[model samples]
Target: MKLSPYFHDLRSAYQAELDDLTQDSEGKDVLRKRLAEKRKEIAFLVQMMELAPEMVAVVFHQGFRFARPMALEQLLGRGVDDLPGWSSLSADGAVVLEPWAASLAKAVLAEPGGERFLAVAAGLEFMQAHSRLAPVASHAEAEEDDGDEDAPEHDDDYDALSADDAADPHNARSREEASDNWLSDVGFDRKD
Candidate 1:
């Protein structure tokens, strides 16, 4: 499904914000903080969109980045129907995103402007809630691990542990506590 230009612009802005937040990070848990801030910003933008969809430009980095100013107005006026097979209007100038991102964009655009923005915000929140950063191994560490033939293979154990964790209320509560602590560290109140 084709997305409206507004949705495309919002997506680009959302991703850019995330990228910017993660670009200069150092130490662990940085992504969690940035994700929290991004969620808050998105929530505010969505609220603004809901209050005044027409007034919200949804433009990031001016019109030069995503759709041209005229093109954006034209798309807004004409709606998605006028732009079949038209997709390449993002800050990255890419017509396609990761399948998951594309699906989220399509879902958001399925709604009207304000609702679409809200959907985007909800999507961000969902992403923030579920995302876990993988540890980046240094080259030396990678080489060391590769050479460790005696290391126990724990793939099955990991799978079983995750399954057990999913079924355990104590584990779930611990995860929630960790999440709450992270949120608080990032200056956000845990949503009840």
Candidate 2:
């Protein structure tokens, strides 16, 4: 799987958001409670969809049931602007909300730009899953040299990018900084 740089960076942020929501100081699982709390904040979070997507996207953690990973894989290769509309995925049955998460899905979909956010949310989860589940081989990582002769001519049409080579550090750093500053302003401790 090869990820476009946009998906690559968002995956890392998405994974981190999920991890933070996974546990509390006691180390016992609190994901459910945390997610519920986040769901309550959907209106505020909806505003974050474009700027801090991973933060907003956590509301849909485990919310998707991927019926057509192939469709999602194809999506991962493109940048945000080139992404297909959400209807394309829904019409093709590429993904659907899990029964338990339907209400949250409804809430998000009801928001302005909800369709766009859902598409980005799916891409983040797809890349995160493939990154964690797949074994690391040089070939499996995101290719840095688009012009390398040895680079596979075809991406196998599967879209997922690994952190190893899937990003522009400057962009990632700026994103991180923006996220941190936002958190600080919102009264949360900045990530170290």
Top candidate (TM-score): 2
Q: What C-alpha lDDT do the candidate models reach, one value each?
A: 0.38, 0.74
Which sections of candidate 2 miss by over 4 Å? 136-149, 152-192
lDDT of 2 by residue, 1-192 (tens): 567878776766676677678879998999999999998988778877777888998888777878998899888888888888677888889987778767766777887777878888877776665554554443455445455778776554333345663476775575567657656865889778
TM-score per prediction, in order, is 0.26, 0.71
Task: Give lDDT for model 1.
Answer: 0.38
Instruction: Give the lDDT of residue 73 in candidate 2.
Output: 81
